[model samples]
Target: MANEHYAKFIEEAFVKPIRSVLIIDDDYPTLDEMLELEIIHKNGDLPPKSDKRWHDNPGRIKSVIDGFRQPQRPLLVDIHDGANVDTKGDAKVAAHLHQSDLLVLDYELDKNRPQDGARSIEILRGLITNDHFNLVVIHTSEDLDMVYREVILGLLGATSDELTEGEQEAVNQLIVEYEDVDENALQALRAAVATDQYLHARLHASTYMRTMGQGQQPYSDFCALADEAGWDNGNRRLVLRKLLADAERPLRARMRNASTAGLKWATSGVRWVKAESVFIAFSSKADHDDLFADLQNALEAWNPAPSRLFMAKLRAEMDEYGVVAQTEALERQHALAHWYARLLRSKGDERRWLIAESVLRHSDQLLNTILRRVEVFATELISSEAVAAGDNIEARCQEHFNVDLSKAAPKKKAEREHNAFVSSKSPQGWHLTTGHVFTMNSEHWICLSPACDLVPGQGATRNADFGDRTPFMAVKLHPVPVDGNHDVNSNLYIFVTLDGEVQKFCFNSQGKEAVSPVWRTLYAERRGLLDKDFGFKISAMGAGSRKLVATIHPAQVVAQLRYEYALNLLQKLGVSMTRIGLDFV
Candidate 1:
């Protein structure tokens, strides 16, 4: 028999509901069905039932949900058999539960049982640990303070208020906002404001940085869970808020985890790609006849410059000056600030890589004149930048805040060569060489011409390794831009930069798309800005493109290309010169 139904959707309109609400109670439709079947005794009441968890009046509760129904959005409902636990609380939530925009979970699964809200908390903690919580409403008749105490201890580890002054203030603000007088869906958001810091720490320590799942390489994304999350407009907002700071608080406790995740997001993928590329190259080498060519390819694939050793040194030297500042690269501003902040952090971290010697040079002056103390020690100065170890919850967890940084900005190229380049620490004689690259205006340019040609009024085979007042012939390299019209591998001559960007000549000289090529002249101690559009030169001679750059300075050399690849590039230059059959008079 068809039961009577209420109007929940418009038949004519095409647009469906935007959000889905799932209400999980102790008992609902099951109890409603029993009442419908006239299972009551003489006085319109059901006899003592076997199930101790059933609601006293489920029909009235169902009516409350029906009252919230609208034709504009979808709604879901479920009933728990029984639930109560201080520690061991588990809920068999379906994958589809991920689709919920607002989860209305009952605080007490069974009123007759203990007020162990762990069942709801367990469900919430799981979703949160995996970053899958929206607006959850713990609807109950009990006082809000009771639930606050339970949730704070369960998730936020309210073990001690050992927070810094600023952190204490931030936490207080978080508490006030969530403790809203109106018992609405957003009230239960306190659990999210101060997310499971321990869970995130564990995720980073045990799972990401250590060994778990793919072992910190690939993205820690729950693609299946995301797919299960509905693709509706409302669901997009739910996912949006996870990253956005409008409804969220910046977590000091989880800074380490955030940084690890960011680094993995940046470096890990490229590392994996390079490893795979090396494997493919090695595999091809076994089948190919040109062992050297295959080996060169494998070597290039295995180690793309700016070398790993350089990064290690850079990190090592930087560590000596300052400790790693654990700040959330993803906090506040628009939804995009998190990503932009991370990119800035990657570059801005160089600021911490200072010259300790510069400060130490004035140590005696500081101790006598500048220091009011009898003797000012280096440890006291170093203490200014020291990071708190363990989960101490210091006041400086996040200090810079929204204020502008008054200090001078970090430079792209460190004035001291050894500060930025690992190779610079080697012999000075090897600084200037063929195929050496110079970084300028945030772009990389390699010396494509021979050392003999770079020297002015030079012999056919002048090999001084490096000469003074010489114009080094060079060309800019850029990552291949895909336009679907030209093949990505337009030319065989390829290059890689210090930041691991795969690059090719600015001009694609492989045939149809080949353009006229030109080279810029670079010289030592010759300071001049490059042409506005140096990459798109239509002639060999250009304004502001030529300068007598004799020897490549230590500060300028970012990396050196392999001999084979450099030779191939030189060969391409010969081919590019003959690209035009004839010239106009």
Candidate 2:
């Protein structure tokens, strides 16, 4: 199946005529595939259906040549065991090198061979230089680090030379930087060099450097040196060299990971093809999880009142763990601020209200700074005559809201209306009317209705109707555990209203497709309700119930409601919403 996939890929991708193919690998299966492809290409017909070769390999050769359309048949030059640098492999490659336009060189070859594919490429660098082939692709499952080093060396024109004075001095300096080094290993490396085993010496030296925490070389400096030494860009060697150089740089200012060493080549530039392993070291996973858990716990326990002393403490702890990246630290602080705000609302602790308020204010300032830059950019675009006069208002709106405003407006309104109705509908036996909006005058609460009996004489409430505005709040969907033989087949939608009310509604999971669109609309519009006045009209309207009923599980419902409320509060205060796990339902 894998061979068939590759054959089909080639047939479709090689729209232009392939003049010839050079298959350089010790792998018999790969060579056989190429040989069969070449035969099919020449015949202008696929192998007969009854052929046992096609049956054995199944779709491998048949799929590629069944409808092969190219008028020109490409000649094939197969070089088996080309990885053996000391053998006639070099002579055979050189003899047939000019006959093919494409070279498919494997990265790994026979384990018994002294030279692998990379080493062969390194040795044949001179012969393959200056567009010797129209295309050359390294195809292998070899370790990326080994491949990277070999490719760089090959591109820069590898040479065996007596160590220069500067190079020797650099090596010595590197050794000195290590607090401890194996004297035996160092002596062995020197002996290897003395015996003119330059390759073995370099390998031993590299291992020593790696063991002594000097594995990272100045990749940028190396690239510069290679360029200065006059390596040409005929095969995009310069581009690849630069990519490798950038990838070698530490992702964090002071911390480095082996996995990240050569990642830039894969991530940046025009990617032609890639083969990568997905497995990561378990230690890396453990470290990541530990750091994440610590941050989450710190955020949950944050108290920002009086000053941001709690945040300072968390930052110090994070710094000790070598997580001093400013952006990452600030993001954690922002999330903590939001998380704490929700706590204050749920607990209504007057003592901690000041702290929560302060954290929120700080978070707001940070968010404003980010939004201001976006606003400035948008304003500039809007002010520009060229953009304003264009017919792409949808594009402009997309730039602002990440959505097509013209298309979304009606849909958003419809969703909002549906959510309002759902919220007003009864859960078990309680029905609530649509909420009114009330803006916050200060951090303290203010009454929306002047004539209302809730609060007297503290503040004058003008008769203000803010319409059926849904309060900006965070919401989470949680599963309701069913009792044995129970019939409720839905989860609960818990909402934290703007004014700190923890409300919930039961939603059937079967209706998620209908509910998700409404929920998303509400979530998106929640920001608009910030610093706004909102209150819902509540009433009990089913089965002569004067108070909340026992048909629904109150304890379970309340627990989920509070949890969602706190989370929503954090989101409202600009906490990273990604932390909320709402997909369970």
- List model 2 lDDT by residue over 1-585, tens digit each: 112222222222221223455545454334555678779989898764332233465353333332222345434445444544542246556656555544555555555643354444443353333233234445454554455444433333222334457645554544343214443433333332231122222334344223222212322333343344343432123222223223323212222122211111221222222112110110111122221122222222221121122233232233233333324336667667776766656532232444545566655645444444334433443355244537875554454334555775544543443433443322211111112221221111111121111221111233122222222232233333211222322322322232233333333233342333112112111112222112222211134347633121111111112223323333332333333546776
Model 2 misplaced stretches (Cα beyond 4 Å)? 1-17, 28-90, 118-126, 129-132, 155-585
* Residue-wise C-alpha lDDT for candidate 1, range 435-548, written one tens digit per residue: 665565566566677744533334313534423344456666553432223442455434343344323334333333455454565554311112232211111222454763
RMSD, one per candidate, in order: 29.2, 28.7
Give the C-alpha lDDT of model 1.
0.38
Task: Give lDDT per model, in order.
Answer: 0.38, 0.34
* Model 1 residue pairs with clashes: 17-72, 17-73, 306-498, 470-550, 522-549, 523-548, 523-549, 524-549, 524-550
* Candidate 2 Cα RMSD (Å): 28.7
Residue 95, model 2: Cα distance from true site in angstroms? 3.3
